[model samples]
Target chain A: MIFDLVIYVLIGIGLFFNILAGIGLLRFPDVYTRLHAGTKCTTFGSIFLIGSVILLGLKMWWEKDTNGSVLALHSALALVAILLTNPVGAHAIARAAHRSGIKPAQAVIDELSEEPMNVTTDERRGGD
Target chain B: MIDVYSTYLIVVIALSFCVILAIVRVLRGPTAPDRVVGVDTINTIVIVSMVAFGTAFREIIYIDVAIVYALLSFISTLFIAKYLQGGEF
Candidate 1:
């Protein structure tokens, strides 16, 4: 009884955050902000969603089902993949955007732009 | 025992709706980076949806596929970012 409720709550939270990410992507003014919504919210939401799956796997294992261990283990592996890759991908995208000359929209203070990082790139292409 | 399969199905459907929203951003984005962001978001959501589907259907293989998809998407995102920066790969 209680287990089902917990799973429901996790799913609800995950679904809410995932939807928020989509909304944020559409509503945000600039690329950086959109990346903020796209990357962080989805990553967080995936955690909860996969976490619920992990819970279900545990429940199954508790019931003495043979497939339960496989389910829980594989789900954990997937969750780990999400946790490890999402942030690094976000950072890479943000860095590339800044390097490519896409400025933040309506910014109050710009620190990275001020202290120009000496990133070596092909000079012929020019900053796009 | 309460059945949560329907809940998982609903979650998958809702996530597909979210994918549509991201697709809008991709279509309407002003810049290349914006489109890339939309694609990245879609990838993440799809990964979660796959896992949910696996749970809903009581299949373990779908979860394995999700894991593989997550890794591949990460690679693609990195390559795209590198290409955007115009740096030598």
Candidate 2:
């Protein structure tokens, strides 16, 4: 009984954050801010969602079901992939966005703009 | 009490709604990076949905596919980012 409750709670939390991610994506004005919402919220939400699945699989395995271990292990693999990839992808996209001349909206100062990096003259001008 | 299987289905449905929301951003986004952000969000949600679906149906293969999809999507995101960077790769 409690097992079911735990699963329900986890699923609810995951759904809530995922929905928040969607809303943030729509409402945020800049690519960087949207990346903030799109990347982090979804990654956090996926952890919960997949964590529930892992618990469910473990429950099945506890009952001596043969396939449950496969379910749990493979789900763990998937979760790991998400954990590892999401942040790296977000960082890459953010760097690319900044390098390609998209500045943060309504920002008074950008520290990165001060650095004379490898960016083209046009991109540097855009940053300014 | 509601069936757990039914609950899983509900989760998938809700995630589909999230996907629709991201799609709206993708459509309305004025900039390339903005659209890319939407696409990245969609990929993450899809991975979660695949896991939920696998649980609902007791199919291990679906979760395996989700893992593969996650990796491929990550690679694609990186390539797109590199393309946008506009420097020699």
Candidate 3:
């Protein structure tokens, strides 16, 4: 019964984060901000939602159902896959967005695009 | 007390709502990257939904499918990003 309640809570929390992700996707000003919403929120949501699945499987496994063990272990693997890949994709998208010339909304200055001031000092060959 | 399937149903419906919102972003996105963001969000929501449905049904295959979906989507996202970056590849 406790595990069941925990599952409900986990799903609820995941749902909230996912809904926030959707709203943020629409409400945010620019690609970066939308990416912020889409990436982090869903990743957070997935952790909980999938975690609930794992817990359910574990609970059933505790009852000695063999299939439950399979479910639990596989869900863990799926979670691992999500955990490893989501951030990498998000980072790639952000870099691509920047390279494609979409400036940040209402930004003043960008240091990333600027050349460093002391290139000659940093590289002795530049001075020579 | 809410039954497990009922709770899963509620959760799935809520996630569907999220997917719909993402679709709206995809359709009305101002720029290409914004659309990509929408797509990526939808992909994630779908993967989670698959796992949730698998749990509700007590069939582990759906979760396995979701794992594959996550890997494939990651590849697609990377490729899209590469194309967006406009480099010699």
- The C-alpha RMSD in Å for every predicted model, in order, reads 6.8, 5.5, 3.6
Q: Write one digit per residue (lDDT tens) for candidate 3, span B1-89.
A: 77876688778889999999999999999899999999999999999999888877888899889999999999999999999999887
Give the lowest summed-lDDT range of ten residues in model 3 chain A: A113-122
Model 3: lDDT to the true structure = 0.90
| Lowest-sum lDDT 10-residue window in model 2 chain B | B1-10
True contacts kept of 1: 0.86
Q: Name the candidate that leads on DockQ.
A: 3
- Cα lDDT listed for each candidate: 0.92, 0.93, 0.90
| Candidate whose lDDT is highest | 2
Between prediction 1 and prediction 2, the one with superior lDDT is 2
Question: Which wins on TM-score, candidate 1 or candidate 2?
Answer: 2
lDDT of 1 by residue, B34-55 (tens): 9999999999999999999999
Q: Which residue pairs does candidate 1 place in steric collision? A: none
| Candidate 3 docking DockQ | 0.87
Q: Which runs of model 1 end up more than 4 angstroms from their true locations?
A: A116-128
What's model 1's TM-score?
0.92
Provide interface RMSD per model, one decimal: 0.6, 0.6, 0.7
